[model samples]
Target chain A: MAPTTQTPPSLRPSPATLAITRIVLIAAAVLFLAPVYWLIVSSTKSNPDLISSNGLLFAGNNIVENYTALMSWTQGNFWRWVGNSMLYSTVAGVLGTLVSVSAGYALAKFRMPGKAGIQLAILGGLLMPIALLTVPLYIFFNGLGLTNTIWAVIIPSCVSPFGVFLGRMFVDAGVPDELLEASRLDGSGEVRTFFTLVLRLLAPAMVTIFLFIFVATWNNFLLPLMMLNSAELKPVTLGLYGMMSYFSPQYGAVLQGALLSVIPLVVLFFVLQRYWQSGLTAGAVKG
Target chain B: MSTLTRPTAPERLVTEQRAQANRRRRRREGRIGWGFFAPFAILFVLTFVIPILVSIRSSFFTEKAAGDSLYGGGGMVETFAFLDNYAQVLGNATFWEGMGRVLLFGAFQIPVMLGGALILALLLDSFIVRRVAFFRLSYFLPYAIPGVIAALVWTYIFSPGLSPINQTLGSISEWLTGLLGNNVDLTIDFFAPGTIIASMATMTTWTFMGYNMLIFLAALQAIPHDLYEAARLDGAGEFDIVRRIKVPMVGQATLLAVLLSIIGTVQLFNEPTVLAAVNPWMGNDYTPMMLAYSSMMGTTSPSGAGPASAVSISMAVIAGILAAIFALVQKRSTR
Candidate 1:
């Protein structure tokens, strides 16, 4: 059998079949990246060049112009949106990872009261289709005067039941109980053991959960749309969205902004690609 | 699981004292475990339980104005309305139509995307291509792209004047028109309301197919290597091995992919919303989620929070039911 997610070979094939499969795979990959290619090409053009130039070819070196223009659209508000997005996604990633890791470790490894109930709650949460909660959460947050505040977006995002589930699974598979027992025997506390040994063991799962939450918070539009009204509080997703009404005229700058906004995540994905792949497969293998 | 000890418990100690000590340790461990779990539990309750309880509670009630005009009321009053919200949501045709549109959209998109993903996984796992890592990474790269950027780029690409698809087809259509001695319009306007769902589906599939492939690929890799050797020893062909071994082994992952796709796509917002942002023809009620949003967002209306909450609840219930049914069918089929 093939190693599931890994690319190491399995079955031998005839030359014809190999050639056909290779062609098909290459064609598919090119087709997949075609839009991103279009965006990259288009982002370098000014508005006039965008109209005149070939859709898939660079027209001029207008990257700086487009970047500055997009940033200056609302008096450098684009920078604020990017900063807000980074802050929310990063903070949410850290907080979500911490809660998920600890909760997962506890549920997976500890002798505890109400474990099943907590499990049930998280499972129930998994079914709730989190986006639906935005309206009610908006209501509650508004009642508490949290609307138009940063907490409106970050607070609701702080918990991801799926992360909790994955974390539990990770703890069960990755961490050995014997090691915890040894730590206790060596006079290490639960907090110390978790921070020292369990944290190291769960690095992959931590990255997995962090990336998931980070992308989610970065990608989120509705929560911010509902909770936030001020321009300064907007994350990049909603900020670009708010700028899209005049999209046809500002198409170049808007496209540039969108692509630039997404680059951080792409870079993050590249850096953490190895761990996330393994962590994800761990879920599959264990399941 | 025995702990290494500096010294054994004194034999002179009474059994009760030792038992009590053991109980205290277990209790202390329980406290620590509870401590570890405290943050999630509190957050889950605040963000999950309270929202759910209050939403459900609020669904049975609505806010009414104190006067004849909804706007003129000095103070809005919250009143028990029984299942009025649920009934209204059920009676709302546009909302149901939006629901139907999303369901119909998912019906075709989910299967085709998953099929593509599975095939890609199988091909990658088989190593028919030498650059397995390169191809895998290429397919998976789109997963990192934000859905908004994907939608915007695709929307731009699919728009009539900006679209290369139209330009390419325009040339072809001119040739066909000349060949046929009449006008032959092969150029497609991909942003029209009629084709918005298909456009949405394309962007969605483009963004997600790789993610699904990763899931399937991961499952494909987990199949035991011994099983393939045994099948080969029994004279099974490559095709036979894939069908009889690889596909069967990854059924759980397939089910998972399907379920996740269902849950995720059922709440479809970003693509349609982005498309609608440019193409107003798609309207605010393009999907159930959109309808829920649009309901709460009018200047003259009384916030429409009641109706919006109802729609949100309805979408959640429908998605839950679909997911449950899918899980059950998979369970049954596997058994």
Candidate 2:
């Protein structure tokens, strides 16, 4: 690995090279940030301003009015959709993290029957796109009268094979076998030791997995679009998409809704940036 | 402690007891291991395995009547129509056209996006750049936004009424016409059928370029500094070092990103679906996943679950095959 802590004085680029590099990077940054700039700027504008004014330019200070109108646009249904999204994402994240982490830890630290088969299954599930399962899942949930309910989304989402794969990798990297042996020697049962000792050690992985699942469930559109028919049960993605589909002059509301849906996640990303970065790097580099 | 110094008989007895306890512990650990695996295993089977089985089974059986269910009910019975749905889905021109469109989109978008990401990553990894952290975060920020929101934001940006792009192009076209004294139209309608794929590609590249960049960046970060020093001692330039050292070192990461993009391209749904709202030409069935979705819901066709299963299964097969081929190629290259 590159010695990131210290750089040799001799290896530093010339002043002109550094200046050129900075210029290029700044240009790239502007390109990346343009849409985000537009999203925030356009959300604050009125409908006429949005249509007539430059998209890159901020036109009016209608943030409060636009947000209020967005919240009250569908008879206070936007907030309900937000709440539903929170509930589903939270439940699925927590439950899915638990299931995946435990399974991953076991697969990493223990010897069990049919372990190879189980590992293969995890790999298969990870590779299989969720789109293939959506149709039958809809039918299965519909048959059980579970469609239009939060469980339809939450139940299927909780079975994240990628989460399990990541959990296993995290366990292998973070947890030591000697520690497990010590815990076992101290008469700690497997479940008890996991809760008191292993869980703490795996906290970073748990947080990453939780946030990953949370964001996935929050951003999910197709599953909820297919599973839930009622507006009350809709997540912000589907709800906002529905709003945008209409020809009504609710572009401002839709933009506000889009901004509102993104804020929590962006906040989460900033706050938990370290864990997310590690998790992502682990997946890409280690796996 | 005494057993260590004790006579053979007592030491033997203690050793036997310890061995028995070890056996007991091993048994218990095995039981607990299965217990730990149970929840995920059950859910995995229920959600993934069962649905796949159901999809495969239904793919072979067409609905004989309108009200027929996969599960026998409603006084409706399904006939064994083996390979019929598969034949329909495979033979369908629209399916092939959609597949071709997606392949073309993937072919154009993946290289540009991944290549752009690689360049950015390489540039950031260079010693010339400072504040690498800020640049990385800025690039990655777009990925945090939901695909739906990303699509929606871009939809506004692509709109002729609100878009700087269209307005700029319109003026440029007028300028060209005036300068040449000939009628020339440089303005391109992004929503038009001929250009929608490129528009969609732009949105996708915007959403995912950062993500792929981060992967490449991570891979680049793992390269040893000694190699760069050696290359520098040999008087290699930055581009030479990147081509000879950094890119070769990050081959696996690049392959992983490409494979992931391949899967993602096949499951292209959200952007096109959202864009279809504004661009009537880019209909719901513009992509394979969308076709499968519309077919599954009977939104675009009356074929019901059988054809939908076939479409989905076909998509899954194609994805599986592409992934397998990539993996095989990667393996061979690494060897």
Among the numbered candidates, top DockQ falls to 2
In terms of docking quality, how is candidate 1 classified? medium
In candidate 2, chain A reaches a TM of: 0.93
lDDT of each: 0.82, 0.85
- Cα lDDT tens digits for candidate 2, B96-165: 9899988999999999999999989989887666678899889989889989889998887888777767
Residues A1-287, candidate 1: write the lDDT tens digits: 33435632544466799788888898999989888888888888887777666787778888888888887785689878889999999999999999999999988887897777777777777667777888778767777898898888888888999888889988988999899999989999878999999999998779889988998888888889888999999998888887886444467788888888888988998888886687568656654
Docking class of 2: medium
Candidate No. with top lDDT: 2
The segments of candidate 2 whose C-alpha lies over 4 angstroms from its true place after superposition are A1-10, B1-25, B66-75, B172-185, B233-237, B330-335
Local lDDT at A152 for model 2: 94
* Residue pairs with backbone atoms closer than 3 Å in model 1 (clashes): A3-B221, A4-B217, A4-B220, A4-B221
Clashing pairs in 2: none
